[model samples]
Target: MKNYRLERLSSQPIIQTADVQPFIEGYDVLGAFNPAACQFGDEILLLLRVAEAPKAEKGYIAIPIIEEQDGVPTLVVKKFKEPDGDYDPRVVTIDGKVYLTSISYLRIARSRDGVNFTIDAKPFLFPTRMDESYGVEDARITYLDGKYWITYTAVSEHGPGVGLAVTTDFVSVERVGMVLPPPNKDVALFPEKINGNYVLLHRPMVSDIGKPSVWLAESEDGIHWGNHRFLFGGRGLVDTKFEWEGGKIGAGPEPILTDEGWLVCYHGADPTHAYSLALALLDKNDPSIILDRSEAPLLTPELPWEREGFFPNVVFSNGWVRRPDGTIWVYYGAADSGVGLAKLIQE
Candidate 1:
């Protein structure tokens, strides 16, 4: 079966980096990306990706990071200034000198109405282990039989890997070590177990050898995962030797079981790496089979705000919530600038 993209969503982007990160010294640029949402009582809760930049470098360059605090994530960064007027940062000491600079942290935000939000003054996740010295980014939220699982990208000099955390309330989070290693990301988990085991969708890429495609793994428990296997691969167009998936594709939000099948929202990019969101439906028992899939994109960069931002032409999400009316509130990162949302209806 073939599917297409959803270009027009009911909800549009309503937020961006309106100011700098409040915690970091001389930091002003701030916004949330990769939002995680859940229903608490009668209100909706969200975990946003708040990004910050430190005092401008001597050359005025900066890097994006999501710092860890206490045990959660928030936006807090370091300010760098060299005594010798040198612009060196401990994160990456170039020009043969090491210096301290501003760091980025991730914070927690709550919303009763789902549109308007209130953020905490401090960070939720601060700099913790050396492995996460850089920070966190792109979190996928999953609520299962009795728990909420968050899978995200943990970054540092060691490289970018996937991390997991489970929580009942949004406040306290139990940290799980890196699940997938460097050069790996885009993790989405099934809400419930399949045959008494957990299911995961992730992407593993290689610049030279293996193409970036969707991979699947199952675990008895959410923490430890094994049975690593490749689930799907891309195909090239007519007269091409490659697959059709263009660049690659990965799981979208947590797979939702419907009468149609196990629907998974996924991201796919072209050879140029122009990213967009797509959809795929798999069999309930045997998720390996592609029941119905999108031939095009579900969402893309079209609006002014979505087209122009920190990182131009990008829409990435790991979290979404379904209201009683069957309306889907999608929390996502736009242009890599800040977090935003859109409304979706499965017709």
Candidate 2:
């Protein structure tokens, strides 16, 4: 058991699948969670990752895909016969090709009091390019250069990669295309430039040589990223007593600049793929240096909603906002089905 605890703000999920409408016809929402949070004027905006799947038929499996024709994008469904391989609620493997049972896109939910949210009927961001043929999911919003820079995962036939979009007002968004190549995600940009260079925390999926862990990168311009450095490792390389993060770890929300240093909330998983959130502090001047890190999880799967759902035993976050009172409001996806809120209060 851990010593520190995060205060659960709501007993139930703040956002669920039932609260959202599918962007495409003949589709059902599977989950509405993993929101990127920020403040716009007097309202708190949550860029929600809404996953939807086509209704099932008797003998065919339907896969949702985005195809462009005549310079226009359209959502199409492709049906396939069950093939030889493993099948799950999330994905199906047909020979060497993998298809997601559900497709995801970003939507905006606005809340004035931070609890009650009114979601936009249409998706805030959806698949438009071939690179995002599979889906676009898990966004992190950072306000910099007088605009809100949104970094998210763009999945396609190639693989999952990092993509960028920007908005001055939430009404109109401009897609900046892919910032990082395939097999990289969980990116969070610093609120401002660090030492005259843009800094971001990203995770590159590794299997053969290195473990999946957090890395630091600097860009002269936000679009071109280079000079990658290993900041920290996951379970096999940390000082934590338990194997809570023995699987992999990734950067969460934008790092909070504190008097002591940069406070970051990152998510980790065990060998079982159970996800949890923890804290890490980095040098204010040089974020590549680790100041301190939590030995135990700050938030984990405990509540029933968090322990069971579309994907069980998960409490993943990509967004958080700091209040005037110094408490941080963390908005996370519970069990990959619903959105929940928690708080980190200064002791």
Which candidate wins on lDDT? Answer: 2
Q: Across residues 1-347, which tens digit of lDDT does each residue of candidate 1 receive?
A: 25333434424564556632476666664456666667776767666666655546664455544456778654444433334545333345646533233344556667777777777777666556555667676677788867678887777766678888787776788887788888778889998888899999988767867777888889987777888888776654432533334776676678878778887877766676656776778899988888877655667767766677766777776777887887667777777676667776654
- Tens digits of per-residue lDDT, candidate 2, 1-347, equal 13335788999999887889887888999999999999899899999999999998867789898778787767789888865455585788766788887889999999998889999999999989999999999999999999999999999988899999999999999999999999999999999999999999999998789888899999998999999999987764555465888788999999989887888889999889899999889999999889888878898899999999999999999999987577789999999899999998666
What TM-score would candidate 1 get against the native? 0.82
Candidate 1 yields a Cα-based lDDT of 0.68
Q: Residue 255: error of model 1 in Å?
A: 1.2
The lDDT of each candidate is: 0.68, 0.90
